[model samples]
Target: MSESIRNLLEQVKNGQVSVDTALLKLKTKPIDDLGYAQVDLHRVVRQGVPEVIYGAGKTGEQIVGIISSMKANGQCQILITRLSPDIAVYIQKKYEMTFVESAHIGYIGDIPIQKTKSSIAIITGGTSDYKVAEECAVTAEFYGNKVERVYDVGVAGIHRLLQNLERIMSAKVIVVIAGMEGALASVVGGLVDVPVIAVPTSVGYGTSFGGVAALLSMLNSCASGVTVVNIDNGFGAAYMANMINHIGESK
Candidate 1:
């Protein structure tokens, strides 16, 4: 059960709230109907994380409406992915927002402090891949995980990657982002003792086929613990890394 439901049940057991009152609280509608969208209000109850807003196709007004509803319902923090700076600036006028231009992500509130000792390391193969790496770093931090960033450490120069051996090996979960064949994932996977999440970005020449070549390369990685996410799916990789980092924590 969710903490909210557990607390409500405890109140009933202690006679602080009547059974009917408890039942009413439990039976409240699970969605917020905003005409354009029916936001899932009980997602945090079902999963540890709450719903995230995808801002690519959403209008600024629509995003504001959804955020308003969530705030009214007591959600303190909100994450918005694939947001443009123009839209983010418009939204920021109404609410405080931390906008990451490179990652194309926006946060309405401060990230919660990490709850675990295990940390997530985000490594990028090249300078071109920093956008995707930043997305992974911000998402992991938002989910309450300490994140370490190691950038421009692709296979083209083994020395750059080797220099950060201690940071790479000590991380509980590593997110490797690369393009142009995506060999960095396998390289990092070989070095790290923990789980490795590979994110292929569309940051290469014509032969890269907008990250398809990298995607295939990652899928066939020889490293045992290397797992691959979809092309440019930084959020998905970070979410998986966060789950792996908090594996032993009590729900």
Candidate 2:
């Protein structure tokens, strides 16, 4: 059961909340319709995480309306991914939000304290991949996982990555982001005992084919524990890493 539902049940068991009140809380509407979007109000009850807003292709007003509906329904610690800076600024004016321009993410409410016993590491092959790396970092952190970041340590300078070997080896989960040949994932995968999530970005030369080459390379990685996500999908990679990190947690 979700934490919220469990809390409600506990209140009723302790006689702190009347049965009718508990029933009312349980029977609350599962969704809020705003015409343009059907905001999911029960996702937190189903999944440990609430429904995240995809800010791309959404107007500032529409995003605000969806967030408002979620907030009214008692959803806290919302995350909006692929958000543009302008829209983030507009939403910031109406509600408290921290915008990370590099990651194109807008986070609202205080971040939950990390409760997972293990930490997640996010590594990037090059500085150009920092945007995607930041996306993974922000998403992992928002999901309440402790994150360690290692940036610009691609194969070009293997020594840099080697320097952080101890830190990388310490994480329970590792995310490797790259755009060119996507070899970093395999290198990290071979080194780490934990799972490695590879993310390909659309950052390469003409022959890179908008990350297809890198995606294919990662998909075909010879390393045993390497798995690949969609190109430029840092959020997905982080989500999977968070789940892996929390495998033994009570929640």
Q: How many steric overlaps are in each model, in order? A: 0, 0
- Candidate 1: deviation at residue 152, Å? 0.6
lDDT of 2 by residue, 39-150 (tens): 9998998886789999999999999999999999888779999999999999999999999999999999876774577899999999999999999999998888899999
Please name the candidate that would achieve the greatest lDDT relative to the true structure.
2
Off by over 4 Å in 2: none
Q: lDDT at 162 for candidate 2?
A: 99
Q: Which pairs of residues clash in candidate 2, taking residues 3 or more apart in a chain or in different chains?
A: none
Q: CA lDDT of 73 in candidate 1?
A: 80
lDDT of each: 0.90, 0.92
Extract clashing residue pairs from model 1: none
Query: Per-residue alpha-carbon lDDT of model 1 for 1-251, expressed as tens digits?
Result: 55667777889999999999988766767799999999888877676567899999999999999999888887778999999999999999999989999999999888876456888889999999988888888988888898999999999998999999998889898999999999999988888788999999999999999999999999999999999999999999998998799887665
Cα shift from native, residue 137, model 2 (Å): 0.5
